[model samples]
Target chain A: MREILRLIVVLSLICGISAGALTVARLNLASRIEKQSDFYVRGPALERLFGKPAEELLGNKISLPIGDHLYPIFYLTEGSEITELAVEAPGPGGYGGDIIVMIGLDLRENRMVGMEIIQHSETPGVGSRVEKASFRKQWQGLPVDEPVELTSQGGQIDAISGATYSSKAVVNGTNHIIDLIRRHRDDIMAVIKAKGE
Target chain B: MTLKQALVHGLWEDLPPFRLVLGLCPALAVTSSAENGLGMGLAATFVLVFSNMFISVLRKVIPDKVRIGSFIVVIATLVVLVEMIMKAYFFPLSQQLGIFIPLIVVNCIILGRAEAFASRNPVLLSMADGLSVGIGFTISLAVLGSIREILGAGTWFGWQVFGASFEPFEFMVKAPGAFICLGIILGLMNAYSRMRGETFIQT
Candidate 1:
């Protein structure tokens, strides 16, 4: 009986120590993320640039609903007669996993300004090349109307040498966003105008 | 029983992945790149060392009935702590590892060592066991990662190793290649052991 009690006590002590340590670690992680977000503007800088307060530009705390996906839209009023909408899209499964891409679109010009890979788990030397500036720069100013094709298909953009699948995934994801933007042009424009009013 | 025996055992006799086949999930998942393999190896080593020490200290007092459950809870807490720290300081590595970071809670090697060695040993001995096993696992992962990275991408540590004319094998970087490469390596290990007059258990 004494042995049993001793065991119980020891187990409880270990559990208690672990719980306390985890609580402190979790708090530290949260604070670090908050600090990093502050440096990156937390998706509000683009909104504030359009002459509207951050909160107003982002709308309600809940993101605006788009077909099947909730997209956070930021309104910018640079008075260049062009409305740019940033969209986050998920690429089909790559060698690593689905790649998350952030795309910038110029609605008036019907072209892409830039595309950035937010996250990917692709192999370091192979699939990671998809995130290289040289690879991504190929998509800049690509017209929305034209099909995005790989160099293998005789298109202008060159695919990463060993990451054909991942490169295709990114191209497909970007094309999907372009199609969505074209379909919702009127509603997107309305949101932009609503911010101005 | 001796420190030399403990160190040597980990390299072959009790290898975490090959002999025991523990921690196979992370062994397969995060070994896509040499960098990722290095990161995971170090993280797992940290968990293994601390968990073994704590488990050894409490082994005498812990009841056998619920020992496994108790060990899991302790290990899970350590895994979460590691995940949190990695995310805070090594953001890129944390992102690269993704779900596998949290999944370390379920890795079998740490639990296996706790049950097989630590539970019956003194704290100091357990620490040594942990260190040896961790080193063995790290070496295995680095070897596998180097092979995959070099052949699949024609690069070594992100530098071009092969001439410009060398076309990398596209299939090698895929999930299928992970299995094939692991199988080949295991066969080679077995063959080498046999040639050295060592008995290889087909586990």
Candidate 2:
């Protein structure tokens, strides 16, 4: 009994100290990234392509309120134009889990600039192909005036070799973002304009 | 326990994954890349070592009836500390890890070790055990991550190993790949153990 008691005390102390040290390390890391990155986005890098700060323009904090979920937003100040919005969007319920992505939109051109997978929890050698630059580049310059559909749906984009589900998820997620942008187009423009004011 | 026992046990005999099968949550979650695996492993290691040491020291004072609750408190506190530090120091890695950092509080490995080992062992021995177990866990995650990264993305540790024409596997970076990879690794471990004339216990 005494031995058990001693063991507990020692473990608690060790946990306490280690946790404290980790907290310090994490804080340092965040600060460094903040110093380096021009802007932070809540969801995708689409806002960056537009030369606008997603976090600043969209106001997403560590946990920002999106339509329903909390998203982390970042921005690119240089590309804040109607034709360039780089934002990151997270596509949940992918083939494996969540597929995190960055989308670049050129509103002036009414098309996609590019797409990149920031992170994902997809299957290896199958679902993870969503991150491949080749797969992502397919979305570049895609007209946003119409719905972006996968080849399965007779769209311009081709589904990944073995990651049809994940590919579809990305298309769906991008389309959703486009819908949101269209719905809030004027509001977003106003916010962008007001920043200059 | 002796240092030799602590180290050896974690490497295989008492591995968090293959043997005890604890902390499978993050083990399967953040291991998409070698970087993530390393980050998660290091973070877990930090938590494991300290938690074991402290739990061993406080084993005497904590009440028996509330032992589980007390253990949780300690572990949660440690998790919070890790979360804050990761955010501050390793922002990119922390961002990659996302919510898994806080979720560490619920990791079975830490709690299991606290209950099974720290609750009965001496402080020094418990610390040794934690280090060994944490290292073993880290290695497992790294190996899994490397396999997934190499096959899925044609890259290892962000370096492109394959030729330009080599198409990367898309599914390997997803959650399903994690399970599949883990399953295969587990099977291999089972085979190796059996080959060595050891009893394979499925828990």
Candidate 3:
């Protein structure tokens, strides 16, 4: 009986120490880790879309109120002036869950620069094929005003051969972005203006 | 066993999945790609080394009846620590590894080592055991991963090893493929050991 008490005390002490140490490490490294993930994973994708270093894009980042949330917004600059907008438009529910994406738009609002899948839980081979350049290429230079949908549904985009649901999720996300852009156009412009001052 | 023997046994004789036939779950689950296999192996190695070291250090105080529970707590703590560190620093690899990192807590190699070696040995020897076993596991996973990735995806480490004309045998990356590949590897190892006139396990 005494042995059990001793064992419990010792084990509790060990657990307490381990948890305490982990708490300290978490507190110390949480922010730095977030920054690293943003730089490593999201950095390359954003760079590919904007043709600018991720660091440069990060400098102009500001979160703007859209609907109920403050969505991340980046003002892409040509030289000294903000010429385009890169908004993080997390789309509605996907085949797996919410498909988060970044959509870049030219200042003239004529064409979408590009779009990149930021985070997704789609299946590896079938649904995950949506991340391939072939599927995403169809979105580049596409007019924002044009309704985005799979070709089978009377739209320009081609749904991935075996991953129609996943493809539709991306298209749905694109439409969500379009809606956000249309509704928040004036507010986005004002946010840009405020940043310039 | 000598220090060198302790350090080297896991490389082949006591090697996991093939010889000891332990921790086969992750071996089959994550070996679809060379990258994932290596990631899972290294993560296991990290957990194994720390748990072995800590367990050895605390062996004297831990009661025999509650030792398994104690070992589990220590192992779980280390696993969580590894998960947090991996998520913070190596976020992409961490995501790729996903649940396997946490699953290291139950890896038979780790618990088996603590019960068999770490509890009886000094810290240095336990550390050596951990490193050797880890390297052995990593090597095994890497070979398995290479086989699967090459045949399944027609690629090596995501690079195209086979020409575009080559049709990949996609079955090599699926669940059945994992079973088939591990079975073949185990068979080959047994055959090779028999030919060498050496017992697969010392016992």
Model 1, A80-102: lDDT tens per residue? 44366666667775887787776
Considering only N, C-alpha and C atoms within 3 Å, which residue pairs clash in candidate 1?
A7-B61, A50-A77
- Top-scoring candidate (TM-score): 3
- Tens digits of per-residue lDDT, candidate 1, B1-203, equal 88677667888877768777788888888787788878898889888888998889888767898799878987888888888888677766777787787788788899999999989988888888998898888888877777888898887667888999999987776778788888898888878877787875563
TM-score of 1: 0.63
Cα error, residue B23 of model 1, in Å, equals 1.9
For all candidates, what are the clash counts? Answer: 2, 104, 0
Interface RMSD of 3: 2.2
- What ordering of candidates by TM-score runs from best to worst? 3, 1, 2
- DockQ values per model: 0.29, 0.14, 0.35
lDDT of 2 by residue, B1-203 (tens): 78789877898887867678888989888888988988898899999998898789888877776678778877877777776666555667876887788788889999999999999999989999999999999998898899999999999899999999999887998899999999998988888887888875562
- Candidates' C-alpha lDDT: 0.76, 0.75, 0.85
Between prediction 1 and prediction 2, the one with superior DockQ is 1
lDDT (C-alpha) at residue B153 in model 2 = 91
